[model samples]
Target: MTHPALIPGIGVEDTPRVFSTNWAVFGIAGVLVLGVVVWGFLAPDSISAAGAASLGWVTDNFGWLFSLLAIATIGFMFVVGYGRTGGIRLGADDESPEFSTVSWIAMLFSAGMGIGLLFWGPAEPLAYFTDVPPGFTAEPGSRDAMLDALAQSILHWGPMAWAFYALVGGAIAYAAYRRGRAPLISAIFRPIFGERTEGWIGAVIDVFAIIVTLFGTGVTLGMGTLQIASGVEVVTGIGPLGNAGLIVIITILTAAFVVSAVSGIKRGIRALSNINMVIAAVIGVFIFIAGPTLFLLNMIPASVSAFFGELWTMLLRNPAQGNDAAAFMASWTNYYWAWWISWTPFVGMFIAKISRGRTLREFVTVVIVVPSIVCIVWFGIMGGTTMLFESQGSGIADAGSPEAILFAVFGALPFGVVLSVLAMISIILFFVTSADSAAIVMGSMSQRGKPEPSTWVTITWGVLLGAAALALLLAGG
Candidate 1:
């Protein structure tokens, strides 16, 4: 294997330059956010409409492509995992006790489940309940409908999905730490191409990974911003802010997170993730107590049965011609799968960073099973409540917007304001955790394996991501 060219000031032994670069990039993005917020206040509808349009186009046209990429990526991970037994190592000193079994599992759950469980838990199941997609047929609001929704949601977030993230991570981690290679995409093909792989092939993979990471992370960031803004609108009746608002929020948030990431993993990312998990657990408990206990209890068995029955079919189902089936795939299955792949680089790097001491089986099982269980329970709690309320004639179903469903359900519950505040806090922390981790990974990749890259490079990616999200929001609007 060819050794990486060591930059004098930025070697494995040096303090990570990526962290510093991330700080500077964040500062710039902050200023841009302020400007966009001002624009949003002046012209909300136009900006929001643009963002919506862009998002629609992407989802409609490229949804299938994202699904295919995810499948391929997942397939690669399985192959690698089967071929190797030891855990994939990352970084210079293998002795670094970065990956504790508890932390490894905690970080994975936090990073992978951010806002997905919180936002989609209720909404997705409800959507599926109303109209059972492929692999099931049931009337909306019926017992069968609720079960179908939970089952489908679990399948979407299950072992298969988590496996994709673990696969990409395992591949990259093995190459970077085990083989003493630079943590770059080109390293993946080194086994096939020999030392010659570093020149063009490596460069292409690095660039491709960067592009995919940005788009994937951008979507998640955008959704996070939207959820927060929507919550704000609900509480204050300030009206919905448009795409410009989303850009401003995302930019500002990105800057803050980049600064946190630059501060290094132990002090920044870890702390944020820890807090995020606590908040999520609290929210889960709150929903369990506030929502219908009997309904949730009944839904689990039904969901489990429906899930197993449809698992294989859902995995292999590809609707080639029908609009309804295509819509189902694009909106739910395809979107979820793509989102998982898009998160691979960020989540993979984060997983690798924290997975230094774990065994392969430990890493795989935690990555795939733990998060899947969390997702399942989360959906059952939140989504179950929404279905219960709707079935009982609470009028939440009339709200119509999937994005608005969480807020609507929360609004109807007792102590709505307090719950909303709690929800908002959790939402903010979730995205912060995601943004901080993504910035760190992107910084590391850009700097070519220097755990922390230059502060400027880190911030540059942060601002660029914020800008791209803004552009997407405008296009979507």
Candidate 2:
């Protein structure tokens, strides 16, 4: 194992002391995360309401900041990839990729934003289309309405989101692998901090990263557990899965993540990712063949074109212009940007962890392009199929909740029940993969970026994450 002092490429005098400093961070962060979880359990409503109010204030006041940073992040990815620095390497001059390109992409894509698409891809477009964004949305059930809705989904889930992640991942990878620093976000500030990178300031940065990772992972787990519980109710004809049922679901799924996390990334994360891709492909294929195949095919180009065509308008539209715009930004665009930003340090480092030995250009291109294109296609097919239902008044857009939208679409297909079960399985696996990957990132950061953190640390994070999710669900979020 590389010592923290030796991990710093320069100024290595006190390795042991530096390791102690990092453990101090680890202890503080763990305690803080547990504290928040306990607080949520004791005062669920107050915590949830307070957190929501804080988020609302930021989204309302700093809407421009989020929009500006998003566009700037995208531009940075493009410039860094094709500029003079295009040929820069992430590691040693002659180093090669740690995993095959396919496996690497699968792992990152799943970790980055896979399971959310199971719901949002179908739900968001339809939701926006039905209510419309007020100022720009088309007439309900019109052809233009279809275009507008698909375009909105494409934009929200497209290249821009991935670009934020690509830049963060690129910076971390270059800093850690090339500069020979621990794979912590703090390491990226080494130029400024130098020896101070091993001190309190650096510890603060890592602590913030860990807290964000823990809370973000908790949110994912909570949302995913609720969705899984709902899907179970759908497939098994089970009762409405009250609070008790949801807790049971969280416990079982959390156990799954703990096991996968402890199994080690090469086996657990990778295998689950392969299965996720296969199951996702199964659903997509089944929908394309069984649904409005031709219209869905046509939607691919139409949605892509419309997304780019309306890019500037969507980017610059002031959310405060009208009630609809305000609600849309608050509920959709603002929330999306916030979640993406919070997850960046976690997902970025996870990407960087598996991205050693790839060139800067290769790294950026794959990070920005592949997931973006995959998102477009997934939304196109899934959203397009749902539109066929909505255009004829299928009521899917007005369904129980966003998480239930995909299952609603499946109900109309042959062997719908079986496919829905597979989907629920896919959701479980995706969350498992994500939580375990996040646990690895948190564990690695806490351990001074050890390539392989101890299994005990990994398991602890996995279980704590599950407990945090249980807390959130109990809190009525």
Candidate 3:
């Protein structure tokens, strides 16, 4: 292993420290996350209400800040990746990447946005088609609605979103690999905080990282479980899975992630991420070939073009448009921006860990550009096929719920059951890969940025994440 090159005067030791856990951060963050879970268990109503109130207050007041930060972060990534520092390697000058280029991209793609793309691939576009955004005058279900729907959907899952990940991930990678700092969120601030980073200031920064990561992963965990339940209903002809069933699903998948995490990154995360990517590609190809082949092929480039064309309008949209526009922003754009920001700690740290030995330009390009392209193509095929069906008066836009939309689209295709089953498998594997990396990241954080945290610490975080997901579902989040 290449030793981390510690920057002098930052207070990090020249030699790596061996410790079971960094008690301050571990105990504090763990207690807080557990506290929320306990509160949810005991008073689901109150906790959910409090959470909703908090979210509303933040979005209503700071929504503009979120939007500004998103656009600015995108610009920042470009400048850093292409500026004077662009060619700087994240680690020792001569060090090559620990993982191959293919594996690197697969792991980052899987951990960063894999599950989300699958969940919203069809639902988001169909949503905008049925109910167009305020700025657009397109009639719902019209050809214009089809173009605007895709543009808006791509905006949400596109470059700006990944920029948040790149900003945090790139900064951390630079600090840890390039400067030889400990890989903690707070450690990145040594230039600002100096030795204070070793005190309560650093502790606070790390605590926030841990909490945000837990909740970010928890939200996805909840969404993935609901979708998996929907898949179960579609494939096995079972009825809706109530909270109890969701908990069961969480329990089984939580075990899978915890085990994978314990096996280490190279053996478990990389292998599973690669396999999941292949499965995802197969599903995308099947949709393109089996659904609306020519339409999907046509929409791919059109969607890419539409995304750029619609980018400025969507980003500039704020509360000024009207109450309807403000409501829309709060409900969608602002909410999504907040979700991506909150996820920075988790996704950012995981990417930084895997990104050592890459130049800043390479890091930024892959982290931002490649994933953005994949997202555009993905939504085009999944959403395009669904829109084609809807335009033909298939009533898929009125499908009872978003979770069921993907399955409904599949139901229209040949061998719908087989497609649904494959989707479920992809989702489960995504669940494992995301949660697995998150557990390891949390473990590393609590252990003061140890590259490989202890197995017990990893397991503790994994189990807690599962419990948190169950609590959120029980609370109707």
Candidate 4:
């Protein structure tokens, strides 16, 4: 990377020469994010295909590396949490927590995995039920397969994934708050280049972080759009929406969240997070009560046991071993890991923002333990309902489209349309929470990691996210 230490003092607030808010960083990062969106808009097929190709090659060639990194994440956190460093706070010794424990955990959990769980809670189990991986689980459509489906879903979203996110979050928070540095990726590399983290070298690192944030935010909006659009069609008993319909949904969502971004965190993010969590919990409870209540309750133990029992196989299985296993790993395991990594920059930063004043031990425990519990219960209820629904000949397991599976699960219940509408609204709100936080974080990075960035900057990032989402939808995201 380029080192511009020759042209600057420490790159922080009050230093006119600090590269943290330099025009070069903003100009380069902005152009990169906007350029990708515009290119995808104008030439979506090629851009989308190229992205797929690059990711595909990485999965095929470096499957072991991703798996190693993921497994290592678990070990890394244990070391941090169990060692003496566990007692260290993320912020200064005298600084108290800004939010209560409950509110803090709620916001982080919502941003970390709310939309994902909404999108995947029903779909992944159903998908696994349709086609369990060879040697990893039993035959599809069997009782054993049902157990494996829930187990696999929990594993994918379980502690391993959360640990990966915590690793990044802890690093950023330690660098920014504890060390009194800007919340930039370059700050994390202080051990290697202590003073140069404030130069163009740091700016280059921040630029990559910005691009990752942009992609994660944009693709998240697009995928959430697809799910809700299909959901609305199912609930209203209308035909599938065309591209124009999807565009309208995106536009409205963009506007609502942008308004929320400008409304400030209290009026926007915190409110949405609390409300969405209640709606999601209600939806989960309804599914459990109305559907197979006892079967899902029974799954809680079996799923957790299976995940721990088979953690090694699931962690290490890859395409290099055999054809069937390879294809399965490539699609499911590889997809999940890559998706989570892309989300780390923005999601981890959000986690960091809300995670100040907590010890490393407390933060790691909450991040890994709470989300893992939520996901297992979520999959157990949602996935177990799918199995019960399928037993009655609903064909929910064969829905083919993942986005449609949640609505299909709700279709079996009495007042199915009403249930589906609840799901749709909850999902939109969950997505809005993510978009709003990402916009604020992106603006924060562009402006020297201010806790609250300018409204105009936040709106600019939100609008850019909308455009990217629309373009990516066109590009087959």
Instruction: Report each candidate's C-alpha RMSD, comma-separated, in the order given.
Output: 5.7, 3.8, 3.0, 4.4
Please give, for residues 255-281, the per-residue lDDT of candidate 3 as tens digits: 999999999999999999999989999
Candidate whose lDDT is highest:
3
Which scores greater on lDDT, model 1 or model 4? Answer: 4
Which candidate has the highest TM-score of all? Answer: 3
lDDT of 2 at 4: 34
Cα lDDT tens digits, model 4, 8-80, are 2222333343423456666898888789888988898999899889978988897777778888888889889
**What is candidate 1's lDDT per residue for 94-125, written digit by digit as tens?**
35556556656667766776877777877888
Off-target runs (Cα >4 Å) in candidate 2 are 1-21
Q: What is candidate 2's lDDT per residue for 1-477, written digit by digit as tens?
A: 963322323211212324322577789998998998898989999889989999889988998798889999989888888887778778766777888888898898789987788868788878867776655657877777778888888778888888878887888887777666677888888889887877788889999998998888778777788788879889889888988998888888888888888888799999889888888989888888988888988888898888888887688767768777778778888788888988998899999888888877898889988888888889888888887888877777656788888888888778889888988988898888999899888988888877677888888778788888898889888
TM-score of each: 0.83, 0.94, 0.96, 0.94
Q: What is the lDDT of residue 375 in candidate 1?
A: 76
